[model samples]
Target: MFVGHYAAAFALKGREKEASLGWLFIATQFVDILFFPFVVWGLETMEFVPGYTETNDFKMEFPFTHSLIGSILWAIAFGGIFFLLFGRKKTSGKSIAFVLGLGVLSHWVADLFVHTPDLPLLHGEPKFGFGLWHNKAATFALEALVLLLGLWYYLKRTVAKNKFGKFVSIGFVLFLLLVNYLNYYVLPANHDIIGLTISALVSYFLFAGLAFWVDTKRT
Candidate 1:
């Protein structure tokens, strides 16, 4: 669920004319942006304990950030801030904020597929997940499809309209795929917390940097 989060935001571009696609992209990964630092600071917990499932090699209890209710609250708070910053209720930006919030929530939905029943439905009682991670091929294929198809839709809808924006869109998606490979394949095999944290920071930089570049060039 690392880069799959941004897929939701990219997909939203098809619906909203004024939506800052990059901002929506940022909104999607907001939880992981916080989760990594929290992991280092001991506010969250995860370990590289292989064999927890047939495929997933890590176990996590990232309640403060990834909890269903917690995500909803953060979505609203961030959406309100988005409204204050660049959105107006009378205009599309507000709706963009709401969609961006859903993009944030989409992270949790994707996580529900990959995580091992650790995702909480609420704060407590009867945790829910389908344990799709145990089914490795299905999980990875679904995630890759979401990542590619979402970007495909974004390209189909927006790329032909502006030159700089077109290049930026393609570059952002390519960069994201490269990084997802490093995170999902290379770095996970390395298993160094410092390395992992640095990787997480690098990803945030890409997600944000590309967003800023595209936003600046976009009409």
Candidate 2:
């Protein structure tokens, strides 16, 4: 659900080409952006428990950020604010609103595929997920395929403006895959939840920044 979330951001740019991919990247991960901070504040919680799932170690208790209702509410707020601030200038506010809202909701959809049934539908239990994370190889393949397909679509829809664009666009995907590998295979076990939360937050912004840079280099 990490880099795979970026697939939504990349695919979205093909349609919302006028919208900033940096912003779209942020939008797709908007929930986790909130989740990390909430974890830091103790408003949400997670614990690193090894062997809980093949790819996920943390048992999460995050309702305010991970719930479907919460996500929709956040999406509405973000889309409303985004449209008022930026969408009004260049495009139809209605379309931008929907796209932005959907961008936010896409996080939940992607998480549904990889996470255990910990994602809540509303306030509490009745959570659901396909739990692809139970199988490491399958999870990796799913994330890689989504990310690669997104990159392919993006490359097809927009031609590189310079050599840097060509190089960085490809590099960006490699970098994300590298990070994914490290997270799944190389990161130290039994890491503190606080440090992990901070790292996750930092990674989100780092990827978003890369998206901004790549967007500027391309169309």
Q: What are the RMSD figures for all models against the true structure?
A: 2.6, 1.4
Best-fitting candidate, measured by lDDT? 2
List ranges where model 2 is wrong by over 4 Å: none
Candidate 1 off by > 4 Å: 53-56, 159-168, 215-219
What overall lDDT goes with each candidate model?
0.74, 0.86
Among these predictions, the greatest TM-score belongs to 2
Instruction: Write one digit per residue (lDDT tens) for candidate 2, span 1-219.
Output: 889999888888877677677888899999999998898888988877878898878789888988999999999998999888877776466676777788899999999999999999886889988999999889988999999998888888887898888878889999999999887789776467677777888889988998998999889
lDDT of 2: 0.86
Cand. 1 TM to true fold: 0.84
**Consecutive 10-residue window with the lowest summed lDDT within model 1:** 181-190
